[model samples]
Target: MVISVKLLEGKKVAQALDETMAKRVESLKEKGITPGLAVVLVGDNSASAVYVRNKQRRAEKLGINFQLIRFEESVTEQELLAKIDELNNDSAIDGFLVQLPLPDHIDEDKVNEAISPNKDVDGFTPISVGNLWIGTPMTKPATASGILMMLDHYNVDLDGKNVVIIGRSNIVGKPTAALMLERNATVTITHSHTKNLKEITSKADVLVVAIGRAKFITQDYVKDQAIVIDVGMDRDENGKLCGDVDFDDVKDKTSMITPVPGGVGPMTITALVDQVIELAEGRING
Candidate 1:
């Protein structure tokens, strides 16, 4: 039986999230407690810069307090930590994030650990990671949270399903697997060193690909009627945005799938803003 994959468009999902955020922000504004997000960008990776800029623009359009801080590649690690310290103590800054893929000399883990958990809206801190594992009300990594939101939006039942997540990165793969487990899905995590990857993926009721490679998963790796979630964004040979899975090849074999560029990307940002608002509200009431 040939299955036609239903497209899970992220733009639509993101718009819905933004609308909800707008209403929540209005409520906060009326209460005279505006939620603020501070984004710190180190070095000048063109892609990272563009992402930060887009985030700032979106935050402004939504009337959320947004601040962007840029630093040169030569900036010292201590300097970056100091800035984070300042944000941590600043009551006006509800949440903040330090952009990823920092320079070689800087320890990413150290920086992530330095951010105060309450202000760590990026959800990269150890405390936040622990909260996610314990199923507490803490900010989760936006990408992981977005994937969960997408599943909920589509009404995908996760109870007792077999979920196979490719890649074991902390940002997306591992946290997502934990979340799936939380929803009662039997989760399996695969990485580069895993054996018989195709065999594992073929058994999955839900397949999430985040290996960060271009068009890596083909038709053979997917099960018939499996829900495929592509979390990778890569530029193809023609400079078109493509996902980790070969969309054309796998579309007809899956029950539903998320499209690249328009799928997981937008939802990630939306989830970040959502968490920020949630944090602000919780802080005020608690």
Candidate 2:
């Protein structure tokens, strides 16, 4: 007998988040403290450009102040850092993000560390990362937070569950593991270097794939009735969006799963907006 997987609709969750954020933004506006986001994009990665553009457009729609700073690929590390410094001192900018996948010559860690944690809305700084582990108030990396938000929205409880995440990247895997641990889930993190990845993933009650490879996780990697969340968004040979998990093959085996395009991606931006509103309200009035 084949089982049909329940779709975890991130678009629906994101809309709810937007409604909450919109009201918060309006409240801030009424108090004369307009929440703002400053985005700095280095180089011309097509995908990054599109993401930044969407963020700016959404910020405007919510009546939040938005700024986008574009720099050439040849821009020096010091030049980028200088721009971050300027935004850091600007009182009007409530949150700021330095877009990722920076140029090879630039030290991404240095740039991330340089941003003031108060305005580091991307949540890449060590301070924010530490706060997340400690359950303190800090902006979390939006993608990681989005995953948790989606799980909660679907009424999936993580406590005491065996949650296995594929990938060890700072942006998604490591932070997400920390979040699951905070939720009392026994979390296991695997990477390319891990031997017999399937054995580990098959034991999970919840499986999150963020390895960035298209359709890397198939039905064989999942346990029956496992909750699957795919964080990878890559175009397959057919030019359609595909995720790390083979949706068609694994969906039947899972209890719930997030789709490639409409899942984690949309929720991430919504999470960012939510955090920005929280930050603005906390700093200005709380």
Candidate 3:
């Protein structure tokens, strides 16, 4: 039996979300409120720069205010913390985040902690993470929320489903598990040390791969007709962009799968901008 594989393209999902977000932004404008978002980028990481640019474009396109704060690689930890304090009190800013992988001198934890929970749109603060697991999320980690948003867009029901997540990082794997568990799905998280990895992954109704290695999850790791979400942004042996799942080798076996570049990437910024707008909406309703 030949099964037609459906592509869960995140760009398409993001575009659909943009239309609604634009209307919401316009409504807030009519109420004299503008959704404001800021991103603090430290050092000169090319990948981080690209991610921040994409975010700026998306936020401005949706009519939300976007701010980019750049700091030199040599900036001290205290200097970064001072800026975080300023943004924390900046009424014009609704939500903000400091890009990860700060230089060796700065403490990433100290920076994340400095951002007030109310303005932690990146959802990395302890308070935000605590809220998410308890099912009263103030702001969700964008990538995990993006994955959930995509599944919801495709009408893939999660209740009582079995979900297996590859990688255990705070950004994707663990948070994705928390959100999926909230939907009543049984969640399992695996890392490099797990024994019989394929046996574990093959049983999942939905599989999410965020492991950094390129093409780590090939056809054998996936079960027939399982919904696969790949969160990896990696370069293949040929120096081209690819995902953790080998798309060519695994696409035919899946019912719905997200492509490498177009899949989980776009939804992330969408979720972030949406969170800022949601917070702005709160300003008036309260």
Clashes of each: 0, 0, 0
Q: TM-score for each prediction?
A: 0.95, 0.94, 0.97
Give residue 186's lDDT in candidate 2 (0 to 100): 99
Q: How does each model score on lDDT?
A: 0.90, 0.90, 0.94
Name the 10 consecutive residues with the lowest summed lDDT in model 3: 105-114
Q: How many pairs in model 3 have backbone atoms within 3 A of each other, for residues 3 or more apart or on separate chains, i.e. clashes?
A: 0
Better of 2 and 3 by TM-score: 3
In the predicted model 1, the residue pairs found to clash are none
Ranking according to lDDT, highest score first:
3, 1, 2
What digit string (tens of lDDT, one per residue) describes model 3 on residues 1-286? Answer: 7679999999999999999999999999999999899999998999999989999999999999999999999999999999999999998899999998899888788888888999999899999999999999999999999999999999999999999999999988888999999999999999989999999999999999999999989889999999999999999999999999999999999999999899999999889999999999989866
Clash count for candidate 1 is: 0
Candidate 3 or 2, higher lDDT: 3
Top lDDT prediction, candidate number? 3
lDDT by residue (1-286, candidate 2, tens digit) is 7567799989888888788788888988889999989999999999999989999877888888998899999999999999999999998888999998999999988999999998888888999988987888478998999899889888898999999999999899998999999899999999999999999999999999998889989899999999999999987889888999899999988899998889998888888887778788976765
Task: Judge candidate 2 at residue 264 and give its lDDT.
Answer: 91
